[model samples]
Target: MPHRKVGSSIHLSGQLPFKDGELLGQGVVGRDVELETAQELARHAALNCLAAAVQAVGDLDRVRIVQMLVFVASTPDFGEQSQVANAASELLIEVLGENGRHARTAIGVAGLPLNTPVEIQVICTAV
Candidate 1:
């Protein structure tokens, strides 16, 4: 809920995969974080993003994903940032259908805040 208001839009911080103050996917994304786990984390991150958008505008139907950036906390050997990011991508596609299709950037990082395997920063616009 701690977001910035900007002329019919609200900016949100990067969404984390935390539940009850506990971080999800504590290890590296491409190593300890399995495909399913990464996907789940991605889904959770997308949901969090959508939730923020909805809360800001008070209408799920009017929100659209403009872009999303996914950061994978992984080992240097990890090379599947796209796959990990797909978790969030697929979920958004499923939820919002065609409107969910978005421009995205997925990259691997040495680590993420809270040590979560995946972190998503989403940009949305209200219709």
Candidate 2:
């Protein structure tokens, strides 16, 4: 597969540490909310994360995705990892069009960096 460069390397920061629909930033005491499971990441809307990752690279036209590795933090019995992975897959497809369709692996792990529900890494052929 050929490598295509779509955007520059940029880091996106400032992710809230809770599920979607949960209060963010400062709140009254005893009102703190948290995500107890990985599935919550989707509830918080993973498409946003996916967009951020894609944006970090810049122009999507130059992107020819070769492969995608989607990691989901979940409980041992959680069988919905694939569903969560689909969130990223769908986002990539929407952003990159036909070129976004590529080899992919959706995996469940005991944990992830900062208890995040999902993390996506990609390999692409640069134009």
Candidate 3:
């Protein structure tokens, strides 16, 4: 529950996909990871960020998204990073309307915690 504010932005702790006794899967390889499946995973990771945002600031309606960074575990041959990230981008836009449209970086990383196929970090301006 710790937060730091500097200028017009708030930095949040790393968040992950989880629920009561459950978590998004791990051990996914990018080459074998379907675009839709990766997208779904990205969506889940984004939802986790939303949960963190709500917990940190108590609302989403007042948020104006500024940036989102999505990291994916990639196989050497996998090249659909941007497509996979669309899921998170679309979800935010769907939930936050114009406020959700923002810059994004979709990166293919060697690996991630829990081996989750995707991870998300969001930055936004909050009222």
Candidate 4:
């Protein structure tokens, strides 16, 4: 399943940066991919999370993001995981306003599925 719901909480599987069924940027940040591209990937993944949340809940306005875990495929020297994740956070705020504010964890990973630069998982609650 793309997401699971229990009571008021919804848990989404890791979302990758995909557009029109095509994977977006790939490779490790601070190496094969630039920071800007990685940021865009992050935003795209977050949008996927929101889309999954809507599919799970049937209505997006009835839910608010509670927390998020962002994994960035990056070189060991990359120190901008938070910066990459910020793009997603910003997108959430842009789409949901105050309801989008959330606790988040931005982590750098050695690799990710499909070598995608970023992946995101979201937790939301029905309001």
Which numbered prediction scores highest in TM-score against the true structure?
A: 4
Please tell me which predicted candidate would have the highest lDDT against the true structure.
4
Off by over 4 Å in 3: 1-3
Model 1: residues >4 Å from true position, as ranges? 7-9
lDDT of 4 by residue, 37-92 (tens): 99999999999999998998888797699999999999999999999999999999
Q: Which of candidates 1 and 2 reaches a greater TM-score?
A: 1
Assess every candidate by TM-score.
0.89, 0.58, 0.89, 0.97
User: How accurate locally, in lDDT, is each candidate?
Assistant: 0.81, 0.52, 0.78, 0.94
Q: What is the lDDT of residue 82 in candidate 3?
A: 92
Q: How do the residues 9-93 of candidate 2 rate in per-residue lDDT, one tens digit apiece?
A: 2333423334355432222111221223333444333344444445655555665656666666666666666776565567668
The RMSD of every model to the true structure, in order and in angstroms, is 1.7, 7.9, 1.8, 0.7
Q: Write the per-residue lDDT of candidate 3 for residues 77-111, one digit (tens) a residue.
A: 88888998898999999998998898999888898
Q: Give the least accurate 10-residue stretch of model 3, judged by summed lDDT.
A: 12-21
lDDT of model 4 at residue 78?
A: 93
- lDDT digits (tens) for residues 1-127 of candidate 1: 5456677656767998866666666888657778779878888878888888788768888877778999888888878889988889998889888878889999889988877888888777787
lDDT score for residue 92 of model 3: 92
lDDT at position 103, candidate 3: 97
**Residue 110 lDDT in model 1?**
90
As a TM-score, model 4 comes out at: 0.97
Give candidate 2 regions above 4 Å deviation.
Answer: 1-58
Candidate 1: the clashing residue pairs are none
